[model samples]
Target: MSPKIHFISGLPRSGSTLLAALLRQNPRFHASMSTPVGSLVNRMLEAMSEDNEYSVFISPEQKRAMISGIFSAYYQPQAEKAVIFDTNRLWCSKLSLIKELFPGAKVICCVRNVAWIMDSIERLVRKNSFDVSQLFNNPTERATVYTRTEALSQGGRLVGFAYNALKEAFYSEESERLLLVDYDLLAQNPEKVLSLFYQFLEEEPFQHDFENVQYDEPEFDNRLNLKGLHKVRSKVELQQRQTILPPDLFIQFNGLSFWTTPSNSLANLIVAQPK
Candidate 1:
């Protein structure tokens, strides 16, 4: 049987990494870290330093080979029954490329509230954990505070882009092969989420002890923070009642302004019932 490929995508800190790590625990799954081709292309562009002239120099064939190379290097020869899972946010930005690379791969798009995701990203940057500013900045280190701020503030838009990309991909592809998992729902009912996930993969769910599942705490790179790049939480609201809702309905559905937006104040007016 051909190796099964699974692509997991979502905005940063939306629990994509945690889900990837958990999926890796399954004996038949080989989930790897984020390896976005767009990110690689972005890096290459930065190296070239040709403003507005830099294009995707790598041909489609080369891009496909690069993705195949990642799988062969990391997952090949592991086990025949093992499925390869690439948990990369960069893939979210290049859904078309990903679809071209793994023609029949299962796409898993994770969803989370835009406000919470933005807040989480803020915490990550403040702690100097993972710097995604490189994607939007040249020399990465020279990334302005506004660039960093915009990345977090535009969580809804990012999620929307990913969702729309996946939607378009699925529109022209098989419907049974794509899955969307909500982070909040999974957090509330992991067992239910896992059951649905297993159903999607057509795999038998097994009982495993998760009491000792060791999750590594994210470490902050103090060296990066030493540059006096202090983290500042913005008070900007994400919801402004735009003309069109972002393509990613999940992002907008799950409360548009949880942490930073003033429009979310209306959400607080709703009374919560006792569970």
Candidate 2:
């Protein structure tokens, strides 16, 4: 049976992990910590592109089945009734294919202030002085946080690629298929946020124990020298203080949340029309 599948994507350090952790509370749902399915899809498409040797033999419909088969193959272990959420930043950029392949599938995009996103990553690097994160391929010598942040937010880096991809999808006609999940709302008012998200997915709500949700992949993070990167507290709570990033760095992306600003077409478009 082809299982119901959705997607999780958006900016880095924007609470995707936390959302996944909370969603796993429902036994019928299957969520992974940044799986490589999206990358594989892209590579398969590359292999069948016009420049590839197999381009002549591969039909469009065959390509579709091949890509879809990847999902079916990898997630075959889950119960046929389970709902799957494939996490990947590149999903946003691939919305056209996703819409074509999955029909009514929706994407849950996690979002937060860009500055704070950078700050969170920088804090990770600073807190673990001797190690650099896989965010930059785990370099041996540590770079200045400012330098690192700049490099990461520039083109082709984690933040930049996801940021650009999200903007493209947010502006696309398929925008209705995307639900934006704010980091603050998630941490501060989880039940409400989750309720809204569940409603979007049209699934009956399941009782979630806010006090005891468990999720962690420290072993995975340690490989990146970003130990505890996906660690979530037993309890979800919002921070009561300002970020530790320097004001200049923090302000760089503070007021740039286009999705929340009322006048911004992108912000208002999501709600003005029903999906």
Candidate 3:
């Protein structure tokens, strides 16, 4: 039988990596950083769309089965696990498809302040001064913090694309399938967060050691010249830091965390209480 499938999504530079690291601690569960399965699913759909001249020969049932097989094929080795959490930022934009593929599947979105997301990416760029990130196309886009931040926040870029997709999911009809977990809350009080997380997934809780948690993708990071991009610290504790971004630029994302407000959508959200 196929493993119980779920998804991990939300903004970049958030705690998706940490969340996956924690989830994988459960022997019955399989989780990891972003996977190519999402990309493969999209490509498969495109191949069967009107853009392909022969798509008329493919029926809806065939398309659905083929798309569903994408996940099964990629994770055939992990079928023994009771659950599998596929990580991909684009999953946030594809909630409808997820509903059709795995009706019971839920998506956990790891989110943080939009300003902090930008700050985190900026810090990574500065840390790897010797290499140009594939996130940008040319030297001009990586010239300065202003250019870099602006380029990344463009609709099609990494941060912006994820952010927009997350917003779309937040308000979508399938919003109930989403659970937004704030990074700060997850780091500062992991056990509490995990308890609630398990409750949401209706799974038996496993003892996750916050201190010894470990996960990283050095090869993937190296390929993008963004080393440590998905690296999770051994300890799961919130690190307090001042903004590395300019005041004006930082303030631009002031109210972008729409999940903080309960009045907006039906999605469940676990956020830190305001001071």
Tens digit of lDDT per residue, candidate 3, span 31-89?
A: 99999999999899999999999999999999999998888889999999999999999
All candidates' TM-scores? Answer: 0.58, 0.92, 0.98
Model 2 C-alpha lDDT per residue in residues 19-133, reported as the tens digit of each score: 8888888988988679989989999999889988769999889999999989888888874656999899999999899988999888888988788888788778777778756
Query: In model 1, what lDDT does residue 29 have?
Result: 77
Q: How close is candidate 2 to the true structure, as a TM-score?
A: 0.92
lDDT of 3 at 122: 91
Model 3 clash pairs? Answer: none
Q: Which ten residues in a row have the lowest lDDT in candidate 3?
A: 254-263
**Model 2: how far is 158 from its true place, Å?**
1.1
| Candidate 1 structure quality by residue, lDDT tens digits, 153-180 | 4434444455454444434434345565
Q: In angstroms, how far off is 166's CA in candidate 2?
A: 0.9
After the best TM-score superposition of candidate 3, give how far the Cα of residue 1 lies from its true spot, in angstroms.
2.7
Candidate scoring better on TM-score of 1 and 3: 3
Residue 135, candidate 3: Cα error in Å is 1.1
Off by over 4 Å in 3: none
